[model samples]
Target: MPPVEEETVVFRSRFNRILAAVFWVVCAAALVAIGLTYAYRPTGSVAGLAVGSVLIGVAVLVVLWRPQLTVSDDAIVVRNVLSTIVVPWNALIHVDTKYALTLITPQRKVAVWCAPAPGATAALRASRAQGTQARAWTAASDLRPGDLAGTESGRAAFLVRSRWNTLREQGRIELGTAGDQRVQVQPHVASIAGLVAGVVAVALVTILL
Candidate 1:
């Protein structure tokens, strides 16, 4: 028998790119404003420039460069701002979307940082108009109409469930040993700590001056 080809699916928010672009624009505007202000009054305190730098840094870290979820043949990779988590398909009991995309295992539930569900109003609207948007909804037995067609998190979950089902049907999913069952979460402590320290330092300087 021929081996089944594995497909890798990536789920990301459509808004992330737009928001990142906006962040960059805001950062550039801030820099230009600071430059013009400094040019007009050379004697002005450097606090303005410092403030602009902090703003840009925060925006870049928090909004512009956010996390994304990738579902591969072997595992689901969650790339967060300060952490990365890889959960094998065998380890994942199910995928859930309430406020965000969550990977459920027997031991724990891990939430994805990038994909967030729609707000209450939007969700209600989505529920009411579920069947009308068949084109947007991906076909998956594990996925709800509100989820697969309604929100970013839903769509991500659908893709994940679809792939999982395929693998299971092909007898590719296997029960692993204790070590393999554990979720792999790697945190970028240095980057997160540095950002926090920088923010605190800026705050202290702003207050002291």
Candidate 2:
């Protein structure tokens, strides 16, 4: 028989999506407002357009673009705004959901930038509900309970834990082999440098004009 392919799961922040949408809308409105107020004066209009571009660029880079957590049978991928980190299943020691979806490995702890845990009050409520659901989780060990899936961070942690347990049972995760290979964190240095350069160039032009 052919080997079964592992399933891939993605966890993303609901609040972050809403926040990103708001940022995008705000940037669009700012640009529209600048265009509507465009005067005949070339210098003033150019400066206003430059300011609008700067706002759009900053919003796109910072607020409108958020991170994501992807879990698969073999590894977990953390896609932050400027960097991406890939960690193998065997390297993950624990999944924590205190302040965020944090992955604890033998070498270091990585926190997911997008999925932030709820506040104390909300978490307490979710925890109480999760406690009840956790007792019934044994029968459907492979599935995530609805109670525990209240928040993005909680859901991400639960998925990671479930995959970790499944992999361990299948003897796919070798704890002893952890830390043999370092996790890879790749930053989008060129993109960030270009953004910085654009901002500086616009600022210099605005000043000179």
Candidate 3:
């Protein structure tokens, strides 16, 4: 059975999904073209190339679709490409978006891959678009590009910060108690292994030719 989200705020980049869809369509078209070429004049080289291309395409698609961030009452679940990190609200110390929208826990800092900060070009354009995300944060007066309401990082950080603030105000989250709560990091070993195998298959086919 597939996992389902119930009473959770799940955030994923629509751009990533659309891009992966476009790439999959292209891959499908390429596969059709490969089949036609094989029918016209079948060759081992053609088969190998087709196989390699398919593997490479699949690997790329996985990368596009992997990252997401989910927020529930108790925790923020960050699903990056290689691993998933679960940070409970009680254990969270601060939220930063210097590079990416990150959760600053006592033990380690976890960056949200899907919510990467805007680069220089974007930052330059963001001055006119700044909002109140930084109002409660450390650098309340000075805003980074990622702290702007229009950015990916800012949007994600808002969800986290909003809930965290509510918890703090309600007296549910205590200060200096971060070490008492446990943060879990789960590596996506199967996904990693599958991607590695796919790359190896593609490389072997390309190299043999």
Among these predictions, the greatest lDDT belongs to: 3
- Deviation in angstroms for 175 in model 3? 1.9
Q: Tell me the TM-score of model 1.
A: 0.80
How well is each residue in 1-209 modelled by candidate 3, as lDDT tens digits? 43332367888776677887888788888888988998897776677768866876776556777789999877999999889999998899888889999999888999998888878776646544554443344255565668777678878888888877776776766788898888899998888898888777766765675
Per-residue lDDT of model 1, residues 33-117, tens digit only: 7777767775324464656475665756664466788988878899877888889888888778877788898777888878877
- Give per-residue CA lDDT, model 2, range 75-115, as digits (tens): 89998877789999878877776667888888888888877
Query: How much RMSD separates candidate 3 from the native structure?
Result: 5.3
Consecutive 10-residue window with the lowest summed lDDT within model 3 = 129-138
| Total residue pair clashes for candidate 2 | 0
**Pairs in clash, predicted candidate 2:** none
TM-score, every prediction = 0.80, 0.79, 0.83
Instruction: Evaluate residue 21 in candidate 3 and report its C-alpha lDDT on the 0 to 100 scale.
Output: 81
Please list all clashing residue pairs in model 1, or write none if there are none: none
lDDT assessment of candidate 2: 0.72
Q: Count backbone clashes in candidate 1.
A: 0
Each candidate: how many clashes?
0, 0, 0
